[model samples]
Target: MLRRQARERREFLYRKSLEDKRNAIQDKKDKLKRALDENKIIPTELRKDALYLQSQLEFDDKGAEGVTTYIDDEYKWVGVDDPKIMVTTSHDPSSKLKQFAKEMKLMFPNSQRLNRGNHEMKALIAACRANDVTDFIVLHEHRGQPDGMIISHLPYGPTAYFNLSNVVMRHDIPEVGTMSEAYPHLIFHNFSSRLGGRVKTILKSLFPVPKEDSKRVVTFANQDDFVSFRHHVYKKPDRKTVELTEVGPRFELKLYEIKLGTLDQADSADTEWRLHPYMNTAKKRKFL
Candidate 1:
């Protein structure tokens, strides 16, 4: 009799808990309905229509979808190998973009080559994720413009670049003294001819004008010079604070010239300059 009574008591508690949950959910639904009804009762047709003499506001038609909160799948593209350089001819790219791609292809000739297609890209991305591949190169062709700008979108939305190091470096590079001082004139060129509107938009958003302007230009140089420059940018400083070090007198170096482009293709000239005096002012160790 005691065991049977205990079972009944447990069953009663379980039913009561479920009933409580149902009541709470119903209460929330009722509250939402009430608020919705309150909003609905206000008739827009009854509102006064007044024409006040306000200053004319000009709005640019640049397409902007209001802030979106996107949901993404759990899978990530982390272990992909470094992207290989692939190339295709484009009439749309600027001269700079074509030249850059040609150079990259020479360096990585065997990298996979494929035509540009959204479906193909999506499939490739899925394959890359499944195969633990984080890096691969796609050479897209444009009319006469260089594809450099198209490269920007490879790390967008659901296709987020899992590599934070590049992101951080890209963010921090312009702030370093050399690039920082001349930063005002830095105009980022879509050196690759395959730029798409989506890629262009993403780049513009990240390095917004009158703010984080990317003015650095990529010039072709001997492999040695390129290697040296990369080392300077990526290298870690040796010592933090050493006693009586034979250090050269500190003078900020503006490593690169900065420039800007106008909307018109004809007047799109690079002609801006600035100098950073704080390039290497920090005595802190590179690692630190």
Candidate 2:
């Protein structure tokens, strides 16, 4: 099993490298095609190979517009199978954090909550892989307040790290009835950019496909890089009226980093993306 896994990883990396080259060529082809269509000068770098790329463009078709990347491989089975998620807290978590982890488990259908105990990260990830868990989430706390979240896609990954704030668990809300366990319809607002789209895919894969008539809804709204999470259930009282009720466990997530490997390989994984808050344009920039 170990040898097979290592060989598969190597094959995936090799394919990813080839995909990167294809994407670069596709980008150049796009630029050349645009310049020609607009009757403008071809870029200096592409002038030498303009004819070759132009000839290659003739072979392109609508079906081949976007080349598949490693991201496609990562989520190839997204809609086909329900994601199996494992939710756990940091080692020796506080009571509040434990409650938060439970709520998270309830949030994602087909998810299981596990006790952290004294298990090492490596061993925990191994167990999850053995069980065929699709995603593993670790909630962290600071002084008894949940403040961090790490979501790692299993087998192979593109782990996302987020700063959690304003967490309101179900236990904290009075009269918040039992949460719904049905697959939820997702609403993602303001995730327009490429990076935003990437983040959206990561978040969306957590939940399975919902039925058209499912009343449960989960919203991830982004404003100035902070994603506010809200859960709701709706009903139609009359022909023209709709009633909505807010479910418990609301929170905000700010992405800090995305690594291209599982949690256990954090030290060796390549950093896919990371927030730079100290940059001069940090205040003016908006990421998702």
Candidate 3:
């Protein structure tokens, strides 16, 4: 009887010892898992298998079908990687458009003024091709107002024509200062879909984007050389031709160019050029 009791006691202790060891190992595993999770020590690529970084993305599919926004996808206009532009104005010597073209060339990084304006479009395009000019911006003036513009990208074209309003000039600025020859960084604002994404396509002719990673210092203030462009377009639906009454929706484009530097900076007095005040107020203010 004594032997039997001793054997039973020994068996019970052996089972208890095994259970304790298993419990210790499981606790260790739990602690290790918690540590790995907290430290983010896992490689991101490896974590992708577990869909770790997926929370940073957005999915915008399944939108309503019939809602029409006149906007388009990102606009694309491919031109020479190294842009070479020929700038010109109307043939009229007295045309203010010529002066506008001169100042505009300064805004572009690498561009030149044509020796003379060519009235013939086909001949002008041929001349540009011969000169290896990738694109051109032609300023058109009517009477005295600088009212029209034409931009053509070489080879294949999404050539664009525009009618400008509230056009302002350097001379118009009451207190304009001499500008450094720094190539101005350009800012394009408020050109929506109805503009056929022409702003970007047109700008690409001036500032071509690189194929690889592009790092740019677009963060300069008005003191630094930078240019801003604003454009607005209004289109009305066709009414009965006899009635001649117009009906449609309209939109606004707001563009402002301020000297790039902070107000306290001595060099920040950029030529004060802006759209006419009447152009802005007259649209909203009911006629007196």
Task: Please name the candidate that would achieve the greatest lDDT relative to the true structure.
Answer: 2
- Per-residue C-alpha lDDT of model 2 across residues 159-253, encoded as one tens digit per residue: 99999999888767776766787789999999998889999999999999999999899999999889999998888999899887788799999
Give the lowest summed-lDDT range of ten residues in model 1.
158-167
Candidate 3 lDDT over residue span 9-63, tens digit each: 4564455457667566545444444546697565443454333223211222348
The regions of model 3 sitting more than 4 angstroms off are 1-80, 117-119, 191-198, 208-288
- For model 2, the run of ten residues with the poorest summed lDDT: 277-286
lDDT (Cα, tens digit) per residue for candidate 1, span 4-118: 6347545644554576675665454444444456875322332231111011112212374542221111112211233332333333445544454544443332334334333
Error at 17, model 3, angstroms: 80
- In Å, residue 78's CA in model 2 sits off its true spot by 0.6
Global Cα lDDT for candidate 2:
0.91
lDDT winner, 1 or 3: 3
| Candidate no. 3 TM-score | 0.44
Alpha-carbon local distance difference test for all models: 0.29, 0.91, 0.46
- Lowest summed lDDT across 10 adjacent residues in model 3 is found at 244-253
TM-score of each: 0.22, 0.95, 0.44
| Candidate 3 colliding pairs | 221-260, 221-261, 222-259, 222-260, 222-261, 223-260, 223-261
TM-score of 1: 0.22
